[model samples]
Target: MKICFITLGDIKSIATMKRALGMANPLQALGWDVSIIALDSEENRSRISIECNENVQVHYYKDCSAKEEVAIKTRLVNQICPDFIYFCSFSFRNRIIKSKLKHKPKILIEHSELASSIPDNKGPKKIALRLLEYYSVYYADGLLCASRYLEREYHKMARQLMKKRLPILYSPYAFNNDVIDAARILQQELNERYKNNTVLLYMGTMTRNYGLFTMLQAVEQVTKQKPDIKLLLLGRGRHLEEAKTYVQQHGLEPYVEFKGYTPENELSSYFDRADAFISPLNDTVQDWARCPSKIYMYIPFRKPIFTSKIGEPKEIFGDDGHYFNTNQPDTLSKLIAALADGRLQKTDVNIDEHSWDQRAVDFTNWISAQYAVRFAAAGSEVFS
Candidate 1:
């Protein structure tokens, strides 16, 4: 089967992009033809040119008027004539694309609810965007939610919007087998770099809602008592400058290191050096809907994780992971101290079931079943 994956965001070193590639790679291995369509920002184009293999066909479009962009997408859809189109998020463009297609199945892969994710977004614009996103979900033939929380929420939303139920699948973020193998080889090198210090790693965009400030505050307190503790912050975002300013103001330069925007393929080397991983997400609807992509990466390293006790993390990690309240920096400090003193125990959960390959197979099966049910209900001939 031929599948087309579409995204309006940059495809370079982003979690969503990596997830798209992960799904595509496994499908390709299973003898399915896969192609990617992404917005043509310079950053995305450069990354695609360097990282994507020759076998993977990629089409990029420069910034254009909304009408023109939709036209371009319609043309591409006509040309590819894919059996299915998997979009990375809900957008007006995607809604139009879904309207244009008659026989092809369109799937929305929701990663976040934009209105809540961007704390700064307010007023009528936010409300309008939220409605657009909800309509996008309503128009899609199916949904591939990143977390079970999202699966339930979007399923309900879609049912309410369409006045009927639509097929919804749970396709959480996961690790690729090749990436895991490569990371294992760099373990010794990473260990030698932080010889005596208790290294704690965080790999994601720097944002306020993600609790970068809270993490810095906790690290400050932890280092006061345990000066041997070190934190390596990876990835870049809108809050990078603000985070740096906070670090400077708090005199945390010695304790915190900002390693900006490491390539997704090279992240395991950084993950290998860390004794523990941390996610300090604030309590918000956006966060509740999110399934941190980094957790899948952290799991294979066999290190302890510290995260907020809410949403998907609470459901997936449960007692196996260390939980903390987002408002309590002292609690985080204590958790860090526990890790530094060799008191915390690592979770012994098997993660092979969540591998990208297995996820791809499951996704494929789910799609097939949905198509079969639809076809049978309509009393029409199946595609193949």
Candidate 2:
């Protein structure tokens, strides 16, 4: 089977790169010819992909103009001629999806988050986004869901809005074990500076929507009880300066450390250095709507993962996970304090079962079944 993924992002870019590559890699391993069609706004950026997956072909199409992009995409899709094409991140580049070819590629819509319900969006723009979301979702022959909440919601929405049920597959976000294995071999020499201090790490966006303030508050309280605890955050976002200002105003310079924007390839080194991790997930509409990919990244480390009991984290970790209320700083602080005083220990989680290889098995089986159904309806034969 051949699969082509279409996403709006630069080569090896952040937005859709993680999920695209995660699925593409395993599909290639399963003897499927995989191709990725990425769109970049930068005209200067090279069309070549420097990703580790050599088997999977990466074609970056320049988004200079809609007409030019369509021409480029049309030519490339004809050349790739995949059995199916997946339009990711609510992107509706359906000129090709609606086109004719020998393969007669089936369309699959893959959503990582609730695009229309994105936080801080308002007014006319929000309405425009909702319309766009509805357009692509309405056109899909099937849905590849990232979380169970999304699967249920989208399934119901299809029936109510379109009066037709879309075949939904719960293909949850997963961790790349390749990075984990590489991290295990690489031991970042952090003994000189952080020898005595217990490093509590966080490695994603620094925005308030992700609960950066709640984490800082918890860290401040943890520092009072356990001064040796150090909260090392390793990402940058809109709230970086604001978070820094809050840290300064609260006299938390000695306790908090913000190491801004580390590359994905080099993240393993820092992951090896950290003793424990924090994911300040909250109970909210936006939070409940999507699966947290960070939790998948944290689970493989088998370290103490301090997070809220909500959404995918609750489902993924079950009893093995640590739970805390981010709304209550003291409660989150006490959990961090447990780790600082040797009360909390790393878990022996069965990380192998959750690997991309495992996720690929589920994806391949489900997608093949969906393909068979599509053929069955059209009075055509399915794959072997």
Candidate 3:
């Protein structure tokens, strides 16, 4: 079967690109023709180039006016005549594209709850965007929610719109095998630098909602009892400087190290040397919808993961990792102390089910089933 994957983001976007390719690669391996349609931007054009394989086709469109871009996408879809179209994000243009397509099955891979994430008082823009998101969900043949919580929420919303149940798939974020192999390589220097300390690693955006400050606070409390605990943060964001200021004000310089914005390929080296992985996500609509891709990225290294009992993490890592309640720095401090004292053990839960290959196979099978149902409804034979 031929499948066309579409994303509104530039091809070089770290998370989106990786996810799009992750799903495509496995489909290609299963002898399916997969094509990725991405918005072209100078940022992606300048970064790197993809070596498209025989089974997978890559197409990038130059930046254009909204009307022109939609027209170009419509033309491309007509030319490709794909059996299915998978969208990576929701936008007005994408919704319009869905409206234009008559027969091809479409799937919306919702990575976030965009409507709730938007702050209040944006006026008509917010209303329009929310409606677009709702219509996108209401009209799609199926949904690929990044977390179970997201699946439940979107399923209810879509049911409300259609007055019937819609197909929803729980496909969490995952990492490719290259990341796993790279993390297997050890860096002697980093290993030596962190040899004597209990290394706690946080690798993602340094934002408040992600609990960067909460982590710092917990680390500070942990260090008061165990000075050998080290917190290694890797990633850059708008709140990086603010976090640094808090570290300074609290005299956490000796306990914390910020290795800003490490490339995805080079992340495994940091992951290799860490004693544990941490995701201190706060409870919010935005976070509830988010399936922390970093957790999958950290899993291959066979490390203990520390996270608050948030939506996806709680559902996925239940009893496997250390879980804490919201706003409970004292509880987090105890977990850290246990790790520092070598009392906490790394989780040995089997992660084969979460692998990209498995996720892709599941997605392909689901797509096939959806297509069969559609064909049956129309009294036409489905593609084999």
- Tens digits of per-residue lDDT, candidate 1, 212-319, equal 877898999999889998899988889999999999998999899998977655676777778899987677877887878778877777888899877777777776
Clashes of each: 0, 0, 0
Candidate 2 residues lying further than 4 Å off, grouped into runs, are 11-13, 40-51, 92-103, 162-165, 183-186, 345-348, 373-384
Q: Which ten residues in a row have the lowest lDDT in candidate 3?
A: 373-382
Please report, in order, the local distance difference test score of every candidate based on alpha carbons: 0.75, 0.74, 0.73
What's the best-to-worst order under TM-score? 2, 1, 3
Cα RMSD for predicted model 1: 3.9
Which candidate number maximizes lDDT?
Answer: 1
Q: Which candidate number maximizes TM-score?
A: 2
Please give, for residues 333-359, the per-residue lDDT of candidate 3 as tens digits: 888898878898766766787788888
Off by over 4 Å in 3: 11-14, 41-54, 93-111, 117-126, 163-165, 183-186, 373-384
Ordering by lDDT: 1, 2, 3
Model 2: weakest 10-residue lDDT segment is 43-52
- For each candidate, give its TM-score against the true structure: 0.88, 0.88, 0.87
What would the TM-score be for candidate 1 when compared with the true structure? 0.88
